[model samples]
Target: MLYRKKRYRINDYVFIGDNCHIGNNAFISSSVKIWNNKRIENNDKITQCNL
Candidate 1:
């Protein structure tokens, strides 16, 4: 997993798999599971699983 800056926010129960790239200003809500090889762009707001 690669995180750009400390400006990202990951809430409770957030599961991010391997090889994931969390960009700057990204927000991941609760109970959100991101699979492997996923790319979360800058300023992304993920409230749920997109897969």
Candidate 2:
């Protein structure tokens, strides 16, 4: 998902999946809650399910 200067209220959940690429100029509001349900795996680099 992409947005331009978007505002979010409190208790917002942002989920980024594996290999997910967040474009530039992405504004994630401070009030938003990033749960990150997907766990990152343990690897030499990063094996987590989510980026």
Which ranges of candidate 2 are over 4 A from the true structure? 1-11, 28-51
* C-alpha TM-scores of all predictions: 0.83, 0.27
| lDDT per residue as tens, model 2, 1-51 | 985662322224544444533333344443333343433232213223223
Task: Report each candidate's C-alpha RMSD, comma-separated, in the order given.
Answer: 4.2, 12.6
lDDT of each: 0.87, 0.36
Return the lDDT, model 2, position 33.
34
Q: Candidate 1 — which residues are off by over 4 angstroms?
A: 1-4
Worst 10 residues of 2 by lDDT: 40-49
Per-prediction backbone clash count: 0, 3
